[model samples]
Structure formats: C-alpha cells, structure tokens
Target: MCGIAGKTGIPVENIQPITDSLHHRGPEGSGYYADNTLQLFHTRLAIQDLSDAGAQPMQDESKRYVLIYNGEIYNHTALRNKLPEISFRSHSDTETLLHLLIRYGTDILEELNGIFAFAFYDRGEQQLILARDRFGVKPLYFRDELPNAFSFASELKTLRLLSSSPLSVRTESMLECLMLQYNLTETSGFREIERLGPGKFITIDMRSQRRQTVSWARPLYTRQYTVQTEADWIDQLDTALQQSMQRQLLSDKPVSFFLSGGVDSSLLAGLTKRLYPGRQLDAYSVKAGAAFVQEGFADDYAHAVSFAQQIQCRLHTVNAQPDLIHDLDRIIYALEELQADPACFFVSDIAARAKDAGQDVLIGGTGADDLFSGYRRHQALYYYNALDNIPAGLRKAGGALLKMLPAGKVRRLQKLLRLSLAPPNERMLQSFLWINRSEAMNLFSADLREQLTLDTIDTYCAGLLAAIPEEHDPLNQMLQLETHCFLAAHNLNYLDKIGMAHGVEIRVPYLDTELAKLSALLPPQLKMKGSETKYLLKKVASRYVPEHIIKRPKTGFGAPIRSWLQEDAAFRENLRERVMQVCSQWPEYFDRQQVERFYNDTINNRTDGAYTLFALAAIESWLRQFTAN
Candidate 1:
C-alpha cells in the first residue's frame, strides 16, 4: 500500500510539499518522476517487498512506462506467472502491473483481483491512465479544472495542496455529509474535486490536456437464484471464501485480524486459523468497557476471548471507549473528508497498536454484511416484502392507525408501520436517511432549503435501486444497492482512510471480486432465511466458527453515543456548546434555533439521533482543517 499524487499537464515545481501531506499513508520510502509533460509523486509503505528493489514510481527497463500506485494486488504473482518471457527485476506487484499493461494494455484491469488506485503513464503515448479498484477500496480523488493541469491523489487534501484554489464547501455535499454522515456520490465535499468512481479509469492526453473517462466494471446483481441444494451451496461458499483468504494473505509483513465481536469478523478470524494451519495469528478485538455494558452494548470482548481460545490464536484487546470530544476533531481531520463514524477513533487506536506490534497488514470482514444479508434494514426488507402481498388500502390504514397513536413505548412499532406503508423507492430512502423531509427542512435555513431540493436524495436512492436485476424482490434490490453504493461510499471509505492514517493496510477478503460474484448469485431466501440474517453464510461458517459465536445477536463497532450524550453531563455540555457555537457562525446553511431544538430532542430522548449531531459538529472540524487553504 502507498500514496500517489500526480498531474498530467505542466509539472508543479514543488510537488514534494503536496506529496509530504500524504506521508502518513506511506512513511517508509518516497520518490518522484518528473518530465516536461507531467510529475508523479509516491510515498511507499513497502508491504510486498521491503527492499529498495520494490520502490515506486517503478518503471520497466525501457523506463517508457512509469507508475505511482496505492493498494495491494493480491493476484500479482499469478499475473506474473503468465508473463514468462519478461525476466523481472524484483518481486513486486508494481513490476507485474507495468508488464501487464504493456502486454495487454487496459484490458488487464478486468482480470486484476485487487484493491487499488493507480496512475500508469505511457511516456511514448503521452497519456496518464488513472484507475481505481472494482469496489473503490482504495480512493483516488482528482481535479480537472486546475490551470493547464489535471491532478490526482490518494486523498482530496493532497490535491488541495497542489492548487491555490480555496476549498469552499458544496451545499449539496454538505447536505449529504450531514444526512448520510459521508458523501455518497462521486462528487466530494469540495466542488473542486471528485472521487474516482469504483471500477473506473480516466486517461489524460498530456499534449492536448484532453481527458476521457470510462467505467470498466460494475457489480452485476444477477439474482440468478440458481437451483442448487443448500448443502452444495454451503460447500461452494466455503471454497470461495478460503481462496480469497489465501490471496489476501500475500504480504511480506505479518498479518493480523480484527475480531469486531460480530459474525463477519468472527467468521474471518475462524477461517484464518483453520485454512492457514500452523501459522500463528494475532487477532485484535475491541472490548466495550463496563460503562458501555451499562449503556446497552454486550460484552463482546468475552465472546472474542472464548472464540480465540478455541482457535488457538493470540487475542489483543483494545478499549472501544473513545474520547469522543477530543478524538472526533482529530479523526475528522485525518479523514480529509467529513465523516461521523465514532468507529474511526476505535479503528485508529487499533491500527496504531497493531502497527507498533510489527503488524502491517490487518484482515477485516467488511463486505460480508453488504454481500450477504445482514443488518436490521435487511430484516425490515423481509417484513416489507411480506406487507407488499397485502392490499395497499390496508397498509395505508395500518400506517395511519399507528400515526394516530401517541409516541409511547411502541415507538419502534410506529417506525415500522410508517416504513411498511412507504412507496417502494421511498422505503429504500427511509431505511438509510437520518431524518424525514419535514425534519431536514426545519434544520436548514430558508435560502438553503430553496437551493437544495429533497428530490436529489430521492433520485440518488432510486438510482441505486433501479440497477437491481431482480426488480420485483425488495430484498434483492436492497442487497445489491448496499453492495454497489453504501458499502464503498460509507464503510470502505472510512476503513481505508482511518486504517492508512496509522500506516496499516486493512484488507477485506470478503470483498474479493470472485467472492462477491458468488454472493450475487445466491438466492435471497438463503441470504436472509426467514428472520435469520446471513443464514447461508452462517451455515458455511459453522465449520470453522463455534455455534455459540454464530448465534450471538448482531452488533457493530460502536460506542454508546446516545448514552454518552444523555448521561455524561460534562461531555454532553461540551459537545452541545461546540455544535451550537459552530452553527451560530454558519447561519447560511443552518437555522441555529432548529439545530438547538434538534439537540434538545436527542438529549431528552424525544429523538433517537446522536449521529445527526455528530455529523453537524464534524462539519466545523473538517472546514477548519481542510478549507483554510
């Protein structure tokens, strides 16, 4: 894994400063390749080959083709085995990609099973090809409007350093950041740059400054629902997951795992020990402390210790308790974009501890929930599908009846009733959105509300749903939507950014292209199996993970945000003061009174929303850190 920054037109005289900004991503080695046409800057972490032989901006003997890349190519050895005639200089994926691009051109991207973002320059052709991996596990941000230049980098802030333009916020992006807690679209928080879409490549003509963008791959949600027996399907899934695990383990440094006390991470840890026998493994598990237990989180650390004992792996426990007040700003700044996931602090802590322990590569179970059926939202889909069979009038009546009832202890039921009656597309949007339209409009200033239409949210939600192959099945549509949109935009973005901040390469074996393809063909029934989420995956996991671990209720990498805001007076007052003070300064986007009301509602249990406040407060941190330039 590494950090790459480059420009296709006039060479920036001082690319080193912009390059230095990404030093945290790759601290081991640094290099640059410059010419009349372009400049490429690279900071290397040296995952595959720790020698200078693996240093990049690597080129072949002819020096005709140069590359500055980030991310790991798991199948590089297999790709190299195919190019027998070309004797290689060093054992590195960088070299392998160079030769492959020479032999097969951009066509080689289809066959590469890795998470990466790269800039491959063809000096002879005077073109720079920038590409991101299939699911965008690695981020590539670029700006085309720069003066006589097209710049790209691993993080948006790196590109900001390359130009003199002020990083003003885009109104739509602000809405996205606050509502969704991250920018879900390709357009970033800043109007000046855009994130390269997953499975996409942009080729720039150095001479004319012309650029052509093409999408090379998209996840095809076939929803084939193949007629295979349950037992046979289980065996196939095991083989596929095991194969991916083997491929992702290709690294020179020691590999570790994150046992997040969830089914996904637990199963991956089990597979790691079972498939790679005789290899001692280290697993990092987060133990939510007693305070968290009091605030409703389970003692998952105990679960992790029990499972690790059975698997004979060393377990290292990290406190899930984070100093939300101080850590939030630091994490949001490190993220380079606005994100409100409290898990970022936890991820950062684990990465620092693991890196200190001589572990460079950490295996995580990120894509399991997106690929297979998991999450309460998926359960909601199950109920929605059953409701679809009933008469529309009855559904409307049910929703109306629930609305008439007071906001009593049956609040959860009220949400389900309203959710069940929503139109198909609205249902999908409701499942993901932080607040309803009325509430969102109340928070925004009048002019801001007029400029931004709620329809944009509807369109984005509908766009993902429209891509579903099995349109009739709500569960299948949601599963595919999560796989294509939410998984990369939200989950993987935070994981990659936060993990790389501590120079740790976080690998997701479940997101292996091959494994994801298999997941697409799975019958929706098998994925959710009546009320049980990830039923088929759980069956396959039974071989490696204990039955007790598999049966545990679903939980995530979480802190008790609601409780923290309600019970801890000092912390609550601190955050409330911070957000109110920030909002008072930014009246163009927010109604200060409404923002205060929102906070009061959440703190008093009138609304279940800690994330909404976090997202708003993160805006101040991000603006202060990123927009000063």
Candidate 2:
C-alpha cells in the first residue's frame, strides 16, 4: 500500500505540499512527475519490492505513460507471464501495471484483481485515467473544482490542500453521518470534494478538461445465481481460500493477522500458517478489560488465545480499555469520516501497537460478512422473509400483541414489524439506519429543522435502495447493499484510514477479486442455511479452524460503548462535557438544549440511545476537528 496525489493544470510546487502530507502512508520513498498538464506524486511503502526500482511515478520504457498508484496487485506475476516480449525491470506489481497499460490501455482493469486507486497519465494521448478497485477497499478522493485545476489523493485530508478557502460543511453529510454513522453519498463532509465509487474509472482529457466515467464492474446482485452441489461448492471454496491467502501473503516484510477468535479471522490465520509452514507467523488480538465487559458486549480474548495456541502462532494481546477523552481528537481527525463503530478506535490502537512492534503488513478478514450473511441482522431478515408469508393483518396484530412484553423485546418486535411492512427497497435501509426520520426530527431543534429538509434523508436512502438489483432474490439485494454501502463505504474506509494512520498496511484476503466473484455466485441459501450464517464459509473453515471456533456465535469486534456511557461516571461526564463544548463552539449545526437532552438521556439510561449518542459525539468531534478553525 502507498499514497498517490497529483493535480492537473497546477504547478509542481503547489502539488508537493499535499504529497508531503501523506508521509504516514508511505515513509520509505517518494517521487514526483510534473509537466505543464499534470503534477503527479507517489510516496512508496515498499512492500513487494524493497529495491529502489520499485519506486513509483514510474514511467514505461517509451516514457509515454506515467503511473502514480496505491495498492497491491495479487495477480501481477500471472499478468506479466501473458506478455513475455516485454522485459520487466523489477519484481513489482507497479511495473506489471505499467506494462499492462502499455499493451491493453484501459481494458486492463478487467484483468486486474487487487485493491487499488491509481492515476495513470498517458503522455501520448494527454489524458488521465483514475480508477479504484472493485470494492473501494483503497480510498481515492478528488477535489475537481480547484482554481484552474483538479486534484486527487488517497485521503480527504490531502485533497483539502487544493483549496485555500475555509471548508464548507455539507448539512446532508452531517445528517447522514449522525444517522448512519458514515456519509451515504459520494460527496464527503466537505462540499468541495467527491469520491470515486467502487469498480469505476474515469478518463479526463487534458486538452478539453472533460471527464467521462467508464464502468468496469457491477454489484454482485446483478449477477445470476448458480446452483451447485454442496460438496463441489465447498471444494471450490477451500481452493479459493488457499489461493487468496497465498496471494495476499506476498510481502517482503513480516505479515501479522488480527485474530478476532471469530471464524473469519481465525480461519485466515490458520490458512496463513498452513500456507507457509516454514515461516514464523505473528498475530495480534485485542482484549477489552474486565470493566469494559458486558452481557452482550464481551471480548474474544479467551477464544483468540486458544486459537493462537492451537495454531502455534506468536500472539500479541493489547488491552483495549481506551482513554477515549485523550484519544478522541486524533481518532476522529484520522478517520476523516465519523464512524459510530467504536471498533475503529480498537483497530487504530492495534495497528499503532503493531507498527511499534515492527510489523508492516497486517492481514484481516473484513469482507466475508457482507459477501456471505454473517450478521445477526441477516438472521432477522431471514425470519422476516418467513413472516412475510403470514397475512399482513396477522403480522400487524402479532407485533401489537408483543407490546405487553419487556421493553427490549417490544422494541425488537416493533423493528421487525416496521421492516416487514416497508417496501422491498426500503427494508434494508430501515433495518440499518441508527435513527428514523421521526426520531431525528424529535432530536433536532426547530431552527436546525428549517435549514435542512427531512426529505433529503428519504431521497438518499431511496437512491441507494433503487440501485439494488431487484431481479435477484431479496437476500442477494441485501448483500449488494451491505457490500456496496456498509462494507465498502464504511468498514473498508475506516479500516484503510486507521491502519494507514499508524503506517501499517492492512490486506483483506476475503476481498480477493477471484474469491469474491466465486463467493458471489453461491446461492443465498448456501450462504445462510436456515439460521446458520456464513454456512458455506464455516463448513469450509471447519477444515482449518477448530470445531468449537467454527461453531461459536458471531460476536463481531465488540466495543463497550454502552457500558462506558452508562457505567463509567467520569467517562460519561467527560464525553458529555466534550459534546457540549463542541456544540458551544459550532452552534449552527446543533441545538444546545436538544443536544444536551440527547446526551443526558443516553448516558443516564433514560433511553436505549447509547449508539445514537456515540454518533452525535463523533459528529461533534468531527466538527471540532474540521470546522474549529
């Protein structure tokens, strides 16, 4: 992994500052290529090839094409074999990509299988092509409307260098950030920037300064599902898992795994050990302190220890009782996007510790949940599918009758009822949104309400919903939404940001293009057999992971957000004071009275609103960081 930044129609001096800002992403090497039309920069991390030949902003032999790229190409060696006539200079994917573009031009995206965001300049055509990987795993942000220029970078912070004016916050982005814990649209929190969607490439003509998007891949829901025998499918899955692990382990430095004790990370750790039996394997696991542990929110330290012992891998455990007040500023600033997912802080902590320990490449199992049904919410959706067969009136009556039950159970039933009654496209949106429109209005002040339209929320949700492939089964549509929106835009974005912030590179084996394609073809039933989520993956994992580990319920990367808010008095007061301070600083985006009510109600246990408060605190932190100036 690396950082790439540049601008078209800008001076070389102007582009160097943004390039310098990304030193954390690539500390080993840096290079630049500038001319009248384009100023390109690349900071190299040097994972694949440790030699100076691996240096980027590298040009082809003809000197007609220059590439400033970020990410790894797992299948570059295979790609090089296809073109034997061209003599390669080094053992680097960068060279392979440079040669591929020389031979096939833009069509090379179809053959490449890796996480990437690259800017390829064609000196011959005087055109620039910008592209991201199939899943948006590697971020690429662009500020297109600069003064007589357009600039792009691997980070939103770097892109901010293109403008001298104060950043204008987008109200819709803030609303989405508070509602969904991440921005929903292509637009970032800043109005001046936009991101390239996954599986997309754009070609910009230097002469005309006109750009046109070229689509290379579509969501998995659009593909036709194929039925196959369970045995045959499991066999294929085992092979794919092995190949993916083998490819992702192609690093010059020691690679470490985040063993979460869940099937996903555990299975990946086991596979890595098996693939390279001669090499010593290192793994890091996070353990929440006793004070942070709660009934439904506990750490996987015990399981992680057991798995590491079984695999005989070196394990490093980090105590995850974070000092949130002290770390909050840096975490929010590093993320660049508000993530209600407190797991992001844990990820940042782990990466920073691992980097301190001298590990460079980190492997994770992040994409499997979205590609295969692994969340409890998926089970709820399955139950809803069954509930749909019942009469609508009967379902309504059943939901109403449950109101006499405990508040928690009643809330769960109400959610089921609401999702069951929603239109097909809206069901997933309602299922995942942290707060509904009515609740949002109730939380916001009348002045704030007047400035922003409630309909904007509906429009954003509806747009994403409409993009789901309705032709496929409902489960597949949900998978598409999860993968494209939740997984890519939220999880993957934070994963990259948090890891790179500590100068550690994280590689996701599950998101291997070949493996994802094969997994996407599996029928929904196979992915979630009855109540068993990731059914097929677990079955294949059983061969490598321990039986007990394979059978354990998915507890995710748990964070004790609620306990910290309700149980820890000092932390609660610190958080409340911090939120109020931010509100006091930027009153335009918040109502002081309503914001206090939200915070007090959440921390005092008056409402089941800890997650909502967590979202609000994140938004406050973001406001303080980005808009305080």
Candidate 3:
C-alpha cells in the first residue's frame, strides 16, 4: 500500500529524485533516511494506523534496524498478543514487522502471512535484505552495480530515475514483450532494471557490494490428504475462503469488489453480500459502448448487474468509449511502460472511476482460476493426462508433423494431439506457454538471441515440476503447478500492477497463504471431477451464489483488441508505425513485409493477431518512452 525507494553508496541528492517519482503511491506522507553511504525514502499511503507513528522508514526501539515495507500483515494483531513485552508505537503493521525483525531476525518472514515487498537495512549488520511476498502480489524492482551501489523501489520507473547509465534495449526482453506480451522474468523492456522475483530474498553487503538471491519460501506440492469425501473437501474450502475474505476485508476505507460477470467476481460479491448484509456495498463493472467499433467483444454487464441486484448492492457501470484516449498516456506513464493491451486501459479506467468515488480498498477474485483449475488450459490438462497411455514415440512423431502447419492450425493440431498423449499437467503448461524457441528467435535480433536463452522459462517450469512429490497423483501435480507458478507469477502480477496503478488495494482471498496450503491437501477428485473445472469451488460457492450463476461458463477479462486493430484505422495506424519504427533497424529478426501483411489483415477484419500486434506495439512504445526520457 506504499512506494519505497532508496540507494546504497549513492549521494542523498541523487536518491531524492528517484523517491519523488513515486509520490502518487503514497500521497499521505513522505519520509527519508540519509547517511553518507545510503538514502532511503518511503511514501506512506497510511492504511492501517493513519498516524505519524506509522511513518516509515521506521526504526526499531533500539535504533539498530530501519525498514521500508510495502504491504499488509493480516496477522499483526495476533502477533502482537504473543509479544506483550514489546511496546508498539502505532497500530500499523509496519511497527509490527519492525518488532518481529528485531525479535526473530530475517526468519520473521516465515511467521507472517500477507503480500509484501520490503527492504530491511540492518545498520547493526551493515547489510540490506530485500524480500517479496510468497505470492509476489506486491512488486519490488532493483538495479545493482557490483562493489558499491544499488537502488530498489516498488516500480521500475522509480529505479529508472536512480539509474545514471544510458537505457539500452535488452533484445531478449524486447522480444519477450513483443511475442509474449510481457517479459517472462525480472528483465523489463529496459536493460537497466530488474524485478525481484516472488518468494525471493536478496541480501546486499555494503562493504563488498556483493549480492545473493535466495528463496525463503517455495511451493511444496505435498498431497497428503486425510479428507475422504467430496463433501468434506467442499466444507474445508468454504471455511478457508470465508476466513480469508474476512481477514482481507480489514481496512479503514470503504471496500469494493471489481465485479466481472465471471464466476470469480460473482462469487466474491456473493460472499461480501452475505458477510456484511445491508452494508450498501459498491460493485463496479465495465460495460463497453453499444456502437463502439468492437461491440461484439463487450462484457456481459447484465450478468454483473443481476448478481449485484440479487445481493441488493449498488452497481456502477462504466461505459468504455473512444474518448477515453486522454487517459491512455497517463495510464502508460503510470505503468512505467506501455502494455498496449486494451485490458490495461479498461482496468485503469475502472480503477480511476472507483478512486474518484472515494473507494480505496478493492477486492477481486484473481487467484480462483489458478487455485481451482478453472481455465480451459486446466481442462486440456485432464485430456493430456488421459493421453499418457499413448506410445511416446508415436506421440512425438505426430506432434512434429502437426507443427508443419500454420501456427494457428499447428496449435489446434498440437492441442488435439496433446489431449490424446500427455497428462493434464503437461497440457496446462503447454496451453499457457507464450513463446516458443522459434517464435522468440524470429522476434529477437541475432546478437540478442545469442546472448539470451529460454533457460529462465525452462528453469521456472522445471521448479514447478520438481515440486510435485513423485508419488503424488497427476491431477494434483497439475493443480500444484498452476497454483505455484502460473497463479503466482502471471495472474497475481497482472492484478497487482493494474490495481496499484490507480492506488487501489486489491486482495485475493484465494491466494491467502494458509488457504492455499490447506486447499493443496484436498483430494484431486474434489478439485476437478471428470470434466468439471473448479468442482469444489462451485460446491462452496453454491452456498452464496444462485445455482444459475454458479453454472455460468468462464469468460476472462479481455478486450476486443482483434476487432479494434482490424477495423479502427487510426488505432491500427498508430500500432503499425510504432512497431515498424522500433524493429526497422533489425530487419533480419522481423519480416517487415509480413508485419505489414499482418497489420493490414487485422485492420481489414481478416485476422485475430490483434493481441500479438498490440504486444509488439507496446514494446516499441516502451522502448521509445524509457529511452527518450
């Protein structure tokens, strides 16, 4: 709920500018700690204590340790009760963390449950320790130079301001942005900054300037189940989800839910309605313009309205229009880099409207799909698991042959073949794979291709695979991978950026550490029964939502980018010029003629490469914006 920035071995004057860039993140208060070798600044949003006592970079009573922390510790009250001997200066979680670190050292992270990105400067130890939440819900980016200095912040833009070096394009990162629509790891479109991976901790030694990165918590895919019945699993999920919701609802400001007509949002709204009846909860949904160019891609706000009506809550529908263009530049600026994805635009608009209405805390059902096997990819996983019976050699041969077709045709054939040959887990992974070696190579310059490899992607996927116990069931392994990797990295990161960009705090009940741990122990059959995705979730949701709503098909929060690029000449022209200019110097990597064909087809309503094209344009825009600045 705040922005933190600092520099080690840098002048205080140099660090101040970086901190100033993040004022929007913490408009309530700002503070800085400076010495000859280090300067730390914190922008406080003042969620928990709303007092001067909660101001950070707060020091321990002994004044030996100072900390800049961003996030909430839900169990602060419980932790406080256990340590009555410690006098708390404020009712903020920041003080609670300061006390815990003093008492337990860095090990205090394991005892807490919440999303966070924090830097604890141990003046006593002459070391700085940076840690992110177990789920990566909050972001922390840092740029390091060996033997002397480093800068860390909540967003890359703040870190960019601290960097004195010229910004260069990281070719691999650029390709990732263009082809995958997002970078796979910490490497941003800019070569100078890197994100701190989730569940990771980095320690820096001021004297040596050496840094070491390690994971304090990793996903442990344990399948030790004692519950024997589906009903038992449902009961456990219900209890966990409700408790999680109650904990996340602990905010002084009015809380609202981002109600998409989907099952995830509907279920959250239903739960909130039941928990606080007659509270007049505010529910927000995006309804696209009726005559908008991409009318067919509009969200079904009727479903969202009906659910809100059923709960007797006030529903606010925001119509997305072309005139919203003025907000696009600001949104891109806030994002620090243009995403070019229309979804970013929509979410930003929603958050802006919600913030304008004076609502601070926003709740969304972001982690449900990853937790309960709710995506089409999960269904593909079930099919793949059934196909494990097929001969490996034959399956490989068939797969290779299928790849000869056009990318779309090849994808369909491969999916069909995977359904007939692999396990559900493998299918899920394949379904979510954004960039292949060939695609990456095609998108990246030769020099960049030589320097970069898909090793990070492989290692990330491998870590998930290794987490599964050898004896665990296949379905459980798939769920474990989705929860640990896909949910933590992709879905959670998306929600965090979009929500925080508008100063809205979004909490995911499904990703509650305790709830996820407990749910992991449920029998796989209960999670996915036959072809039904999120079987257990539906059963638990039945208690809150109507049966009809519970049975509705899953529709994701995506924009009609395909239709927009295909028919909107102005949008297409902007996208095409950006893409062409950025990639013009490296013709070997990208076929300009093919790119033109792709854009023309898209604009003429002949192709759905809109997402891909938009991603490319985003990377181009990011390159131009960051480098020029």
The runs of at least 3 residues in candidate 3 whose Cα sits more than 4 Å from the true structure, single-residue gaps closed, are: 14-16, 289-298, 322-330, 337-340, 385-414, 417-428, 434-436, 445-456, 467-486, 585-591, 597-608
lDDT of 3 at 401: 78
Question: What lDDT does the true structure give each of the candidates?
Answer: 0.82, 0.81, 0.71
TM-score of each: 0.95, 0.95, 0.89
* lDDT pick, better of 1 and 2: 1
Writing each residue's lDDT as its tens digit, candidate 3 over 1-629 gives 89998888756565456657777777777888876667888988777888899999999867878999999988788888767898777889999988887777668787688888988888877888899987788888888865587988888888877765666666666555544455654556666778887788999887788899988875545667666677777777888887888888877688888887777888888987788786788988888654332334445587788888899878888876643233445555666643545666667777778889988778888778776778766676566656676787888899777766544324545756745654444454556554444654555555556777665655666666775546357666666666555565455555667677777777887778888777677677777788798898999889988777777766656665555555566766676776686578555456666667666654554433556676666655565566665
lDDT of 1 by residue, 203-303 (tens): 88887888889988864575566779999999999999999999999999999999866678888888878887798989998888776666556778888
Candidate 3 residue pairs in backbone clash: 381-424, 384-422, 384-423, 385-423, 385-424, 566-602, 566-603
Candidate RMSDs in order: 2.1, 2.3, 3.6
Q: Candidate 2 residues 107-182, lDDT tens each? A: 8897898999999999989999999999999998887664457888898888777554566887777677667778
Cα lDDT for residue 535, model 3?
Answer: 90
Against the true structure, candidate 3 has what lDDT?
Answer: 0.71
lDDT for 209 in candidate 2 is 87
- Considering only N, C-alpha and C atoms within 3 Å, which residue pairs clash in candidate 2? none
**Who wins the lDDT comparison?**
1
Scored by TM-score, the top model is 1
